[model samples]
Target: LHNMRTIQHLPREKQMQKATETMELYAPLAHRFGLFSIKSELEDLCFKVIDPNSYKFIARKLREKKEAREAFIEEFMDPIDEELGKQGFTFEMKGRPKHIYSIFRKMQRQQKPFEEIYDLFAIRIILEEPHTKEDCWRVYSIITDWYTPIPKRFRDFISVPKANGYQSLHTTVITKKGRKVEVQIRTRHMDDIAEKGVAAHWKYKEGKEGGSETLEKFVHWVRDVLDNPRPDAATEFVKDFQLNLYQDEIYVFTPDGELRTLPQGATPIDFAFDIHSEIGERAIAAKVNGKMAPLRQKLDIGDQVEIITGNKINLNPDWINDVVTHKAKSRIRQYIKQKERQKAEEGREIWEKRAKRANIEISEQDLTRIAQKLKFDSTQDLFYDIGKGSFDVNELYDVVKQFTSKGRIDDKEDEDKPAPVTEEEIQETYINAARSISDDKALVINGELTNVKYSYANCCNPIPGDDVMGFISRTGDVKVHRSNCKNIHHLIQTDGERIVDVSWAKNIDSKFLGAVKVIGEDRVGMINDITDVLSKSLETNMKSINVSSDSGMFEGILTVYVDDIDHLGRIINKLQKVGGVKSVFRYE
Candidate 1:
């Protein structure tokens, strides 16, 4: 694919597509397999096809300065070549040209044009086998001794090969001509691997006893990428492949000093998953370099990491954004999907129970009818919506009634019906219906009343701070209501003696369910921001939160557990300040 991209006579669109494919596949594959030379060539070829003018301009300048560059290289290598000869070191010297892609990158990164880029060419010293390792270092010392080496630009890869298994000694020094030049010293074996990578490893390992295990690991990882079952295989494979190709690897140590390698920008969560599946799932936080760190904290090379786990796994939906590894993302998504399945099953059960209470037997036909009435694509979708609180139970009940009734009602007549009864009126009807049953039970005043059973009116959902009253039903049980409840006057007019003064206990510790309604302009991340605010408040337990949006406008209802009116008010006040919220008020 990479070579195909460089065919200039091909259509520009076809060439670009080939370039993209090469970037998505071959470039990363080359990098992973330790073929730095091939990877650099592939990148430069793609750059040339993508932007021919810039590549031509850069190439032209480098060609124009070819003579001067050769002269500089000769001047830089002369003293080192002579010193190595005097020291009886057998070595081969070569000039390494910097790839156009690398030069282009330097131009962009340093915000400089071609004229400002130093080290466009480098010198490599390849030593013979008899004293390969020692001679490589000896040559490095001789070169640095003859010139002033740049301390920061020095890299001792011979001691620590790169993650891709390229080993060399690299240094940048000022030559006699005051020009900066890069020098790479390595053995013939290392040079072969650095140039041809995994291919060379296999090609040259005929009689070698223990072959490159690092290269073996790289090959295994590539196999895994090919074998994994991804959700969207082509797109996901391309994305992950590109990530592997372009990112640098960071090596961090486990508590036991076992080194773990991860891509640059990988978080501790990725590290934990890389260690073990269970460790990643149950990870609550992390300790990086002996200090507590967030799960999303990016790791650095040589840092020690210790994963912190708890009894329960913290597989939050937000974890997908924090993790960069395919394994972690796959696990988190699977867990979330399983949880959704469970919730949908639970919602189905709730619907079944409601159907039984209404004396309606639900069959597949009934479910299909209800699903159509709700405008849902399928019965499963309807159940899932119910589970997520996006569908109302009362509306579902009405749908069931229509299906079970003796006669089909005319839709136009239903549309023309009078306004629906207020919640207060519905509660009044319930109280009136209970007037015929007589009982001797007294109302419980915050556990003060014994041998008595009472219930709260759903209309008001009154809490500790509200003025309260109790109504004695014919069944003799008491029903509590807010003193200012809309039906209070009617109840007093019909059965004044039934009304009794009621108060919450002075030190009640119980929580009451409160509802708040919010109106806002719909925008991305609004729900996340709202939930973040609610989660931060102490003792705030969200029972249900439902939001609906239409044409950029949104309305939401949040039901929560609160201590009293005051606690509910505090929640409302906090919600009112959230961005995009137009109004936040208690719902009666």
Candidate 2:
């Protein structure tokens, strides 16, 4: 405590790690042990360490006028208690103090001072026992009687306990004082269950009669990580289990009365995955609340989810981004990788068969060595490149043929051909590659062949999987452009003979460089500060960064190399965590 000061500083990575460990770990553990008070305290401590400025600012504001804060809580609780009493809920209602850490986060995110952060405080409602499940509904109905329910804000976890085995009804209301406060309604059993989390289920069964076996079964699933074999296999299990332990859940249902518990904002895909991994894998579409919706559709409380599956293979990698649950996302990534590996292996086999048909004899070692030199890890990857038509087959054949024959190879082959010496020859070669409909080099846009003419568009850095089109050039060659590229619209009137159709390959290898401009209020070490955050927080390499400041505002442009769209998302999340970042987004 002596070392604690009015101001403290630590590397942002340390703060993130501390947050992941404390708030995401020990706080949930304390809750599992029925230590409600301790769990809240732990969370507050974590917030304080992670975002000190906001925490300190809020503390000072609340402490400045103790009576004002007390009056706020009283005004916050009056109507809630009146509604609970009128509904005959045997209950206890009270307000919990706002933790320093939480206040700090609110201040930082909202860019407000301590005095403006009022929602940090919350009111809790703990109810007495009800002999039947209907009694739980009775409590819910009672609370809604006095307060105008925010349609999307109500959560009914009583029917289906959360992945972490937590169950409760949570809703928020605007008090007479125009202050918004959260109200948590749960029976005595639920109160105990909520406070203790998974342990409440275990203790209820092992130490008391009339405990729930259903909850016990769920607890066993929660502990599957401990019993699982490989660390990789259980990483998701443990991560999802821990991260979701104290989450806010919504109750969704199936037509068969089977209940599905989901984190707030979960989609149909998440529900399907939660039900079973295969179900999620095959799920192409779904009906939420009996209305057909896209797989990305969000599920709400009392939503009846019906998944649609098809015999055709349509498990797309893009689905990974749409899923909300950690379990769902992890499973999607796993399946996509598995499918890619299988394709690569099949491609390798096909390439091997093609080599055999071509009378080319090469050992697996020869193929593996050549593949490694070309940035591949295995023969399958080499074959995958071959199957995807990325590598020149004629070149690959010569390389392999040479490897098997002690470097004695044909000197007259096109593999060693010199580049065209004249512009006319280059133009003719380009025309042949473009105009030859049977050639793989011809730009086929969405499977349609057109007159050869097109050049690569500059804007948006169009890559594979992106929608694209070809523009005709006066020189009788096509210029390829993303369909949405801003420059494409201006070039549509070019020579018709040069306008050929274009499309992206099924797989892409090139890395697209993206830039982001971060603007915020300036402070000491602000430039070095952002650099440290980017270097440490992000996974990909940062190619270049430029920072400048004048008139109290600091701004920087960060150029990062991304493996793909998914990696870009993680980088965006990291940038959003930087201090004083007024805005962080794509540069162009």
The count of residue-pair clashes in candidate 1 stands at 6
For candidate 2, report its TM-score.
Answer: 0.53
Q: What's the number of clashes in each of the models?
A: 6, 15
Q: lDDT of all predictions, in order shown?
A: 0.74, 0.63
Give one digit per residue, the lDDT tens place, for model 1 in 1-588: 435544676643345445545655787788878888778878777767555545776889888998988887787778888999999988899886798878877866755446668879888889877665667877888887899999999887776566667779989989776789888899888888888887777754665522457567666666644544545445554665567656776788999998776788889899888888799989998999999998888888788999999998777778888777666776776787678778788778888888888878767875765586567877877888888888877788786787678444323423435778774564445445544342444434423443344667888787877656677676655677765465654565455545554556566657888988888889999988888888875448899999899999898999998898889879988988899987776665
Which stretches in model 1 have alpha-carbon errors above 4 Å?
1-9, 176-178, 204-210, 224-227, 340-386, 390-588
| lDDT by residue for model 2 (232-310), tens | 5554555655655555667788878687667777888888878876788788889877788988877777889899887
TM-score of every candidate: 0.60, 0.53
Stretches of candidate 2 off by over 4 Å are: 1-42, 65-67, 71-93, 108-111, 127-175, 206-210, 220-248, 264-267, 276-296, 308-318, 326-334, 350-369, 377-379, 397-588
Backbone clash total, candidate 2: 15
